[model samples]
Target: MAIIKCPECNHEISDKAPVCPCCGAPIADHVVTCPECGKVYFSNQTECPQCHHLTGKEVAAQADVHTKPTNVHKNNRIIIMVVVAVALVVCGICYAFYHNAQSDKEQIAYEAAMASQDADVLQNYLAMYPNAPEEHVDSIQSHLEMLKAIDRDWTNAMVSGSKSAIERYLAEHPNSPFKSTAQHMIDSIDWSVASAAGNVESLEAYIESHPDGDYVEEANDAIKNLNTTTVQPEDKLLVAGVFNSFFQSLNARDEEALTSTTSPLMTKFLGKSNATRSDVVTFMHKIYKNGVSTMKWQPMDDYKISKKDIGSQKIEYTVVFSAKQTVTHDDGSTEDLQYRVNAKVSPEGLISEFNMVKILE
Candidate 1:
């Protein structure tokens, strides 16, 4: 190895030497050097060993001594860079993942901004990255088209008396992300349109189709304002059957059966003034004991559902009942009975109310 000049002094020193040994200078330190005494000293020393001269170079040189470790680190970094490059070649597939991850982040931001009605922000993002992924370009175009269409539809629905324009747009863009919003707008408009036209059939159909729609209550309110209407003939059958059974039971003196046929409220009302089960038993017992068992019951004709009213697809049917009954007592005494009955029927064929009157004959 070639000899190195001592940094502490201007003395030639052997490279492997620990010190100069001539002036007791630390030659291997390569740091502080005496300017006048031609002596070397350790880098931390503040004076020349031979001449006792103060020197600041020792401190500066000590501060710089750590730089040699950095050169080794630099060389190590070169080796690491080479390894990384080789790894990239061995796993080329990782690059695609990196690209897709970055693209997804951009797409998420663009979609979020668009949803928040920030069209300018979205446009700026698109302008900055005009050449986005091919797969995302078509989606972005479709979203932009939907936004424009929705704005136009809102304006048309506001100006026009109908929401048909909005409905048409939604039908055309059924696959669009704004389809649900378009549907909501159309449903809102349907209520006003149906009400203006007094189209009960259409209103009922719409309510049936969209049970949980926002317009359901409003459409029903409109239906309730319409004049009362007649119920169907088939529904009248159930009303007549139930009333006839009740009338027959009353005439036959079957108090238990009659009570069973009447509603709970009607039963409670009748109990205050009418015969109980014991009274019916005593009457039957007396008739059997006397052997005067002539009892006749006849149902009246021309019974029908009348006084109808309709509201929000519900129908109310008012029915009339007339009947006659004759009973002979044990001593051949006879009694003739005549009845007039009125019953109210609900939309679902359940009886709501009934009143009976004894007609004098």
Candidate 2:
């Protein structure tokens, strides 16, 4: 029932009609009216037909409003990722700093322990840092063992209370830290031992062994006090020759020569087991018959003579010498013997006493 004006004929027509009746023009279902000019046009048109105004301006404004929020969201996501990355970097830096500080502390402690050069300190370090450097750990362990062994040896030497033991320890561990202490102990012990013996021979031996010893003056004083007697060089040679002649007679199995060189007391003492000198000669002959083939004696340079008075005008000289003997037995077996020969020589250059003692292997 509504009425509309037709554009071509300017005539009145029904609004619901499919065409305008006056001009016979078709009506469009998607028509719009331009407000500015009161003109009718298709709704899909870009501009108003009467005024040429753009129709999609509102849609563009709406699109701008929607797109702005999406861009802001994307920017916010990027900011959040950047913040997270920065936080991670800071945390890593802090961890690395802490780790390096801890490692430095450990290294300082290890070096301090090593500088101390104390076994207990090194042991504590090993216990604290089980992952220490391998070569360093091994060195610490080896040094500790050496210290322990040295301590043990030192204790044993002190306990033994012998000059020989301390000397042996010093000989074995010459580079030990306690070398000076051990040497001092040896000097003290040697002086004590020589003083206890209270003899010129012991003191002289001590002086010979320790020329620059701490007790050299004391030893010389002791020697001057104990001994005032001296043997002439010619008497020493005479006694030495008598000993040589006695042994030569024994090697030659000359019983008459042996009896002539031997003192009357020594011959009597030898025959104590028998009744007569013939029985003594028979005893010697039996000894020589067992396995004796040949005997040789080489004298050493350590000859000493002591003059002793035995209630006579004659002087008895006690002579001692170190000698080596090589004995060839009848069974083709040879024996090398190290022994000391002690003989008492009378004023007539005869052997008054004779004894042989084994010295060493």
Candidate 3:
């Protein structure tokens, strides 16, 4: 039996043995020797035990080719793993950057919409970013609803075209966006009504209520026109007599005479504290009882008489007079007074209302 080297471990073994004792490599029947070292081995043996070198010519060539390829495959696997890890890391960074950029974009759009204070802009922003911050979403929705409601109310008010309706809307929605427009409409309506009336009192009342009114110039012009109109002498005398009778009755301290000079309605309506005509007479009598011992009236040059229709077949006349009233008190104190008297006369030649105020010196 000749000695042989194991193919796997290069251990010496019998060539006749089917398997090597040290490496369990199956031995071929043919014997061989290492050409370089002269070590004996089987034909199937790829290496010599004595020299620790490959022995078979075909075996050495095959080993050389297979070993290099296996090593290359392992190195390639490691490189592939590293590349996969790096790619995963790069993908993660890109995803994070994209997510953050999208969030920032949404935030910026929301802020811009809020700044506009427009309902449409805010609605568009909500449509673009449904996942916007909770607080901002709720606030935008509320503001949009409010603006829509105001628009609805304002449009309804304009359609109504009534002064009271517009005024009611303004009172209800003090902070409405159309506040200025509503105010202008109210002024315009007032001006139109006052112009159509074509009366000095109505125009003067408008001017008083709206000092900075849009039709202030027109109102002044209307007043000037009315003032230029003339009054008849018979009408002036009739108005004057009503006032003279009222003052004379008041000075006389006779409740019966004073009450007789006034219409029953006028007697009842005089003196806010008096509930009945008798109460009004008693109240006036009390004022005059202790006051003047003697009173004299002299009419002045400035006097006005105007008539207005109260109802069908009923006319009311207003008399304005500047008069000198000299009063001698019971204590012997005499006062020379300048007085202004405004009196309203009924159609039946009775005084309907009397207002007396002392004119300042």
Candidate 4:
């Protein structure tokens, strides 16, 4: 070993020492002695600072060759360099293989999550692969949020059990995969309501609204039976037609046709006292003038008043109907409304008395 001075305390020490035993200073790495000034400094320096002496190549040439012949020293150094280089290459290969295996596993899990199309599975993937690529993480998060929103909307629809609620879901999620299911829910609900009413007009309304619905055939068959079936106390088919005509005329905004659907002796109209046909015509015309562009009856089914079934030439019936009207103004804006009415077609198949009912969803 060569003699050298400690950098911190200037005490002499062996080159192979780990620390300065005399001064207790830690030995620094890659240290060397300046031959000219006998000063010790790190091997990375090119010169001695105390005497301003520049170091020559002799310092490096003699650094590791002092104990052996020149040729053997050179060969030993070459072997050691080759060994260190090979160790570095092996380390790089091992690390690359480990990184690739991790990437493959992550890819497999991501593909499975996408295939399942499940929200929970995607959430787990995010928690597991926090260091995943930016694009993949963004796509997964977006899909998961959409799935959650769809579930929430579906839950609300089912809990409410209302056609409007179900329809709102469809409207909000136009491109949803549950499109067909939501539409079926609406169709089945309408069919059930029509069946419960058990009237020719209600079934007819269902057929008109959903021509391609699942219950179309059944509704048509029901209507055929009601047309031919003898309804007690009064002709149900004929009386329902009178109520239908009244709305049809009202939609057409034809005042004369609307007046014809009523009786000359019509004394009670829409809870109005001693209201005449003229008064009815005037009131309806006022609504039309206000901006009612179209009036549509939603679904109608009438119940015949069996207690008042006494006349031969005329029949009295209570009609419960729902309607919708659109109001459009000159400014190109529009409003839609739900309308309902409970009225009686007093003798002569004319609407003599009427009452407005609460609007429905």
Candidate 5:
């Protein structure tokens, strides 16, 4: 029998043996050298087990073919490889052209939508193509330019008091992209319309109704500047001081102090009926025992003095009050509170109409 060697360990074995007895490597097979590591192994393996390098039967086949004559089998394999490579290159080019064509179609649609000045069409295009390309920028710029013109026309209509056109336009196109801008334009018209109409009552009422509206602050400022009734600075300060004194008197629960400052109208307004000095003192004692500590008052910028009526025999102005108070309980815990007070003063420097507004906790 012919002796064979194991590829893994070079152990010798009989040619008919299935495995080498020394290293347990299979021996009953044809083996080849691994090109990367020069290690001999079974020809069917694609990688060398020792070096882990890729090797294939193709390399061995090509080597065999080179050793033989160039013939029909060799020519056929070469033609087949060339045909497959060309087909792959053509497929790549076709895919690129198809993608480019689709992109061009979308870009043209975006431009056409903008040029038509139809907001619906533009929004639809944007929805369909959220990732717009660089080419869409020019169309967007043109749309912005058209919107600027519309804004100019809207502003002029408001200034010239011909707001009907803009109003009708806004009503007709409520869902227009410029709806927020149109609302601002309409408010500007409201300011001019309210002022030019010369209805002070309506103006004040409108301002009061729309406290946080866009026109509220501007309307208030206009009212302050356009006020025809003027009060002496000294009298304005005195009335404000008197109201403060009255609040302090009430806060301290000092009946004598409150009675001295209050007039007959104020007494009635405070819901007191025919009470003299002694009775007031007794009532104040009871109130002081039951009531919590009176909170202090601080002034705020929104607090102001305005005449209730213009140029009447009865001079009148409003005295607005705002204050932040810290109330302490007997248990030594304290809480902060804020108050807003509005007082309408008569010619006699008395608070005729006193209204307490919201409290903030």
Candidate 6:
């Protein structure tokens, strides 16, 4: 057997073989190149005796038919490729549209969540897009965490029932959802503390801190009560001191020192209205200026004190006292005087007014 080239693929093969192995082209005995047609064919046949078809022209015609089918198949493959490419482009466009629309909806929801003060709005938004691949996913998760932390801190603050705790909550979360309520609670705590103390300074401090607090009216009332209460032991001691100074100045018949023990603007003195401290000085001067040498006026232990009306921006008390006097006349005659005297003393330990209500002797 001799090696020969395949007719269709030009692969070397056995000449005695019935077909070429590479191209599977049919081979006949003595297959060789046809000189007239420049193609591979059986050399033993010039033409078919029965059909009388010439080998050179017939093989050439067969080659034309074979190449024609190959061209047709290539065109079909190109058309199928174009159709598939168009389908993929359309699918990509549809997917992009769907994702864009979903993104728009998520944006709207996110804005609403941000605007709302309610924690539930944020929670619902988180529930819908948890662990999503959207751009604002991290932002939503961060907001949810912040809200949770605020809620946790607020609950702790409320449970503790401490003013400092509430204050700390306000300091930490200034923009918290419970900000207003938290501040109000702190204000109430201050008022409660001040009220429990029951003092003017403490209540005044509360007023200074919260001018528009819920208890402002009540605070003012409490202050008024404290200022006006007449039976206070401390207040009584102050009034007694003022009475002593006034009597000491009177017994000496010293005009300036007597005026020093009285208010600058006295409303009454020696049974006169719209009186002045100068009026008291002049009255004391006239009592001892002549015919009375070494005159002495003394206050007795019997004292009655009551609340007088507030005047000249001071708390005034009406004090009634039994008084005694001794006058050594220039003529060497001695005289004894007894009087039930009434006076008004201010909280600043100063006398504002005085009168002899009754002559006891």
Task: Give all candidate RMSDs, comma-separated.
Answer: 16.5, 23.6, 18.5, 23.5, 26.4, 11.1
Winner on TM-score between 2 and 3 is: 3
**Which lDDT tens digits does candidate 2 get at residues 1-361?**
5565655465766656776666554443433456677666544455675798666876345445545544564687688889999999999999999988877877887778767535788788789878777876887677778778988998999899887888899998887778888887887788888999988888998899789899999999877645434566776677777766666766777888766766655523332421344544665566555687987766776888898655554577787788877888999998888887776677777665556678875
The top-ranked prediction according to TM-score is 6
What digit string (tens of lDDT, one per residue) describes model 1 on residues 169-266? 66665655556776777776766666667766877877886788888988787665443453345565767776666556655767776555544432
The TM-score, computed over Cα atoms with residue i paired to residue i, of candidate 6 is 0.49
* lDDT per residue (tens digit) for residues 1-361 in model 5: 5665567678766756766677554445445566777766655556677997776567556445443332443566578789999999999999999989888988788768876655567667767876777568556656756766666765665566555877776776565556676667667667677778655666786676556668887777766654535455665676767766765776676666766655544432324444344444454455444345544444443547766554454567767767555655555666676768766666776555555555855
lDDT of each: 0.63, 0.71, 0.74, 0.73, 0.63, 0.78
**Candidate 6 worst ten-residue window by lDDT:** 42-51
Candidate 2, poorest ten consecutive residues by summed lDDT:
267-276
lDDT of 6 by residue, 180-240 (tens): 8987898899999999999898999999999998898999999888777545777767777
Better of 2 and 5 by TM-score: 2
Per-prediction tally of clashes: 2, 0, 0, 0, 0, 0
Span of 10 residues, lowest total lDDT, candidate 4: 302-311
CA lDDT for candidate 3 = 0.74
Q: Higher-lDDT candidate among 3 and 5?
A: 3
In order of lDDT, best first, we have 6, 3, 4, 2, 1, 5
By TM-score, how accurate is candidate 5?
A: 0.31
Query: Would you give me the overall lDDT of model 2?
Result: 0.71
Question: lDDT by residue for model 4 over 1-361, one digit each (tens)?
Answer: 8888887678888888876787544454456666777788755445676775766786555434432443453576688889999999999999999999999999998888776557889999999999988888888888888888988888888899999998889989886667888888899999999989988889988988899999999998777655444354446675667777887887777789988888775657767767777887887777766554554544346343332444453445666666566667656677677667766777667877776755656
Cα lDDT tens digits for candidate 3, 9-34: 78877777866666454554444667
Q: For model 2, what is the alpha-carbon lDDT of residue 64?
A: 53
Q: Which ranges in model 2 have alpha carbons more than 4 Å from their true place? A: 1-63, 66-80, 111-117, 171-177, 193-361
Q: Is candidate 1 or candidate 3 better by lDDT?
A: 3
Which candidate leads in lDDT? 6
